[model samples]
Target: MSDKKYLVTGANSKLGKLVISFLLNEYQIKPSQLIATSRNPATLQSLADQGIETRAADYANKDSMVQAFKGVENLLLISMDAVGKRDELHTNAVQAAEEAGVKFIAYTSMPNPDASPVFFAFEHEATEKAIAQSRIPAWKILRNNWYFENLIDFYANVLHTKAWLTASGEGRHAQISRTDLALAAAAALVNSESGKETITLNGPESLTTSEMATLINQVLDISINVVHLSEEALEEQLESFQVPADAIIFATTMDRHLKENKSDGTSEAFEVLTGKKPQLFADWLQENKQSLKAISNA
Candidate 1:
């Protein structure tokens, strides 16, 4: 393991970039000991400039994945972006990692994968199953909850339109910042003792949709109407707003899960991993207020 290198897939993604940055800057992992991979090598020029090994790895290409995993000791499989193709892609990655004799794997997954009624949970469950079947020496699953950044889109629209509409009637979500999740992931990867663990990462608090709107209003100093609609009504509203049908369906399903109280906000796994309290929604908003204001103005 000491002679092998750390490999991070999807190193160019927002969350992936944060994880890699934390691994380098905070964890003090040498760039020479790290390999950052993405579908496009050009996008990872900064990492290459930092002396990190860069590689091209397409999730769809089994050979590319196998080559990328070569000589890798530990791997962080940032969940694939290709939604529908995730299961097969994840399987290929697992196979490649095993073939490369990877000692440990840390995968980013969704919260409550087994119990989540949301349509998106299928891929996570399948990936977890594949990892278990692989009999990998060690594994850590970071089951991240909804990101606070997800609210940027709806909150921006609400600030402009003066109205926030959702299909999640009385639904509550425990949304954490992606950066915090990334920190937790990096901490887990760096801690040699944290192996074969499955953790649910969420915010310090769970908030209802209406509560979220109130918080947004408080932070932005604006009044925005928060309206909850039936699933069908929300679908129609989203369609009218030009959202794609598949996205609308997925959103509605997630909203339904929230309404059913499927989310567990009791997880302190993030704090345990990172040795710090996760950032709150208000602080996250305050930090990004400038960008949010710009979007509102636009």
Candidate 2:
């Protein structure tokens, strides 16, 4: 058993769970050395059953965070699910970790947090700043790109309407898989050599919105068209889809950033950290083709 203890906040979340699974299954880290935390401990019963410590650590509850971090040597502060309350919640987590004397903190942040037009980037930047001022011995910031899972949100529309809409305006994205990012986080946490680092995790290749749509169609054996709209038009279209107004605003803002080429870059950071190339979009689509069919049929 490793002497160090790891606490993963939001351990029940999709990315968080993947990170925990990778840490245990891939790295061969002992269950006793890991602590999985969620707002509801019931959601993490499996981890508890496996001999991993589980705790109900709500970001809004400082005392719960404090208790969760007690004796923890490293912390993986997965960003909170609650969108608006992220800054406050993250701040509380940092404070608790500092209070607990955690030696290192690995934060899941977003791409180009300092200049990202994405509203969520602001929260990540704030969290990074908080971690910097917390007096922790070490910190690693994983600025992840858009997850491949996000493609599913537009999958149905692309299948049915044979069209994909975007405000990106031909801008490219170096999309990376959530699993890949999770694995990188696990490797960084487990490796004592990482020290304090800020890594931008991205896919091996960058592709434009239209190019991505083409790849998806090719992999699914379907025909689809890419529709690029101005930011204003995209907002109106999103509203028509019943997307919340604030969400539309945020999406448009991110689109503007993409248009300015703020999110595009070929980074080997993922491979460097995990010692393997990040999975490509077409390959992921081919692997999950059946699931896409099921969702489209349903």
Candidate 3:
């Protein structure tokens, strides 16, 4: 294997932070060989304190990304939260990696980005294509299923509102904890196999919002009625929570995705990659109940 270093972009993000930890702890990767990049490098104090090199890499500034990627061989391109700007930002980052002579990329993407009807998926599709066209020799497109973490705030909100509201009518999707996804991504980062691969990472079970709500109730020891809404109604509910207009649209479209598609595969892919079984959703929920309760009270 080459002695070139591995790097993570969006280092301060929720997934990025966890992936770094897994790489350092579980993978036993030396801090000297890992770099973390964020637009606001000052916010990466935690990573820096661990002796990992932290650099400024702003997606809006391709030059900055190119500068930050120097000497980096592998990159964990955690998708940014820039709704409308992901394609442009990620394409530039791929180009920047090439410009800086970086070798491989492992991107966290939504399931079926090319065909999924989710509003935010087109950019992922574009970024995937950009990576394929790039000069970088190898890549891994880790198409991550919906994160169970997406519901933490919603569960918290429902704890207060007493209603689990959704527009997805009897839709089901395999969901996994964010920590498992990080472990998978970290494994991909450290894997030195030199070929293009696309892996769809899904949880062990497909679950509807209602089923999830039941699990939530069991976890929190409280009752929450599952209320189905029209997509329009769902948007209104999101607005009432002060969610941004764009995010409201995104949430509804995700419901459509869940209602329409299936078979993203099971946790075996996660186990194969990480050599560990993904934590069961119920188990995860039980463990995180205190945090959910705290959010509810917030």
Cα TM-score per model: 0.94, 0.95, 0.92
The sequence of per-residue lDDT tens digits that candidate 2 reaches over residues 84-189 is 8788889999999999889999999888888978877788998989998888989898888888887676346566677777788878789888888889889888
Candidate-wise lDDT, in order: 0.84, 0.85, 0.85
> Against the true structure, candidate 3 has what lDDT?
0.85
Which prediction has more favorable TM-score, 1 or 2? 2
Model 1 Cα shift for residue 295 (angstroms): 1.6
lDDT of 1 at 167: 72
- The parts of candidate 3 lying over 4 Å away from their true place are 232-244, 262-264
Order of models, best TM-score first: 2, 1, 3
lDDT of candidate 3 over 157-248, digit per residue (tens):
67777687778888778888898999999999998485898888988888888888888888888788988998889888889989987778
lDDT tens string, model 1, 128-238?
889988967899988888888876753457667878777777766788999998898888777745558888898988898888778888998877797889888988888
Clashing pairs in 2: none
Q: Please list all clashing residue pairs in model 1, or write none if there are none.
A: none
What TM-score does candidate 2 get on C-alpha atoms? 0.95
Q: Model 3: clashing residue pairs?
A: none
